[model samples]
Target: MENFNAQFVISFLIIALGYCLKKWNILKEKDGEAMARLIFNVTLPSLIIVTFHSITIDSSLMMLVVLGFVYGIIVAILGLFIFRKEERRNKGMLGMLIPGFNIGLFAYPLVQGIWGEVGIKYFGMFDIGNAIITFGVSYLIGSYYAKEDVVLNFKHVAGKMGRSIPLMTYVIIFIINLTGLSLPGTVIDITSVISKANMPLSLLLLGIYLNFSFQKSYWKGIGRVLGIRYGVGLFFGLLGFFLLPVDDMFRYTVLIALILPMATSVLPYSVEFKYNQRFVGTAANLSILISFVLLWVIGNMIV
Candidate 1:
């Protein structure tokens, strides 16, 4: 129990260090971009492979992948309806933000620290469905809402996910698992070295990109977005907790996932779609802070 609480504190301190490094000009804005690229292209993919390489594919595990897809679709529809009155660009960005969970860097480390490799595999499946929304659906929504008339290109969506290193690693690793082929120990050893960097680097990247300033006028929009997000999250959390027939671990995973924050990918999507980047950026940081508290309390109680 003490270890769990300690992990949360250490995580926050690392994030704070990243923030401080940026504030002191030790890490510039472009450095943040570089770090992000490193994580997305290299460390993250390695982490995905290392963690998932040993997972046994089963019907129950596969169900998490399906639920992940369904969860994203449900939240996106709700987000679109909730923000229907807004201008198209903002509407699309908000909708994208609501659905994608920050499971990779944010949830993975915390879950790993508390629940070990088994927990990661559960969330990893959940994240597979999440990858669809983050890499495909969200991109399409953002492109649709762009000021310029953009063609709806399904190929573009597929290509984006295809090109993503992490997603590709996930699919390849899972396929290998299904085929009953174990990753060579040398490959696992190499990936393990790179994967160890993922958590600290991810949190550090969050701190590097952290933007705390909230425009006075944007407060209303931010409040509404967060309010709807957590409200829906709480509703689902309770439903899965009391009603689901799954074991305690499954129920807890669902609860933890429900309360997770919006994906950091929203910042790039906001940029690509020409939406309000500051709003999305601020919301991302805020969600991390909010989710940390929620996860910490829940971990102590449930785990």
Candidate 2:
């Protein structure tokens, strides 16, 4: 419990520092696009490569990925049905927020801390499933909100999939492992160095992005978002906890993973789709804040 509290406090403090930096204009909105790119294109990919390269695959681990996908799909379908009566704007926000989890920015480190290297490796697999769903189903839903020319363009879809750094990194690492190739010491060292930057950089960017966009008026929607997020999280957490065949640790991890906030990527998608960007952005930031408290509570129970 003490360890969980300490780690939770440290993590929240780092995120708070990021918010303060952005609030003071030390980190501006203009910097966000580049920072996000760096995370998506470089740091996260490097971390994935390092993780996948280090871990061996197993059937049980693969089952976790399938389970995660099933959970995401279920939540997405539920959101679509439940939010049907909401305004188009709110519906769009719900669609994006429902299935999108910040697995990369937050979950990876938190899970790794709790369960060690094996947990982190499982997280990478979870992320792979997440990426596929996000790009395929979530993209379609978000695009519908954006009123994009919905067409079946396999080539365009392929190109988008090809550009995903984390996914590609996983594939490459998996192939390397399958071929029984070992990473050279120098390469491992380089990846390790770059991978270390991911958490701090990502949290800082999140803070900066929030500071530039946050408004007092947006706080009104926070309660509603939290209600939905935690409600769904608890439902799945408890359901998986009792019903799944997994052990306590795996069950706990899945529960906490579900409780994480919507991803930051949802903001741009909301903007592009003419959704209520203010609501979506504010909700995401607030959800992340709430997650810290929830993590501390859950960590105490499990750890």
Kindly report which residue pairs in candidate 2 clash with one another.
146-273
Error of 2 at 168 (Å): 1.8
> What does candidate 2's lDDT look like per residue over 1-303, in tens digits?
776676666667777787888778787777878988998889888787777786777787777778667877888888778778876656666776778678888776566555655667767777667776666567666766555356556576567767778768877887888788888878888988898888788777766765345777766455655676689878888788778897666677677777887766677777777777778877887777778678877778777
Each prediction's TM-score against the native? 0.95, 0.88
Candidate 1 on 69-103: residue-level lDDT in tens?
89788878888888999887778777777887888
Off by over 4 Å in 2: 87-90, 152-155, 211-226
- Tell me model 2's lDDT, rounded to 2 decimals: 0.74
Model 2 TM-score is: 0.88
Cα lDDT, model 1, residue 27: 95
On a 0 to 100 scale, what is the lDDT of residue 35 in model 1? 86
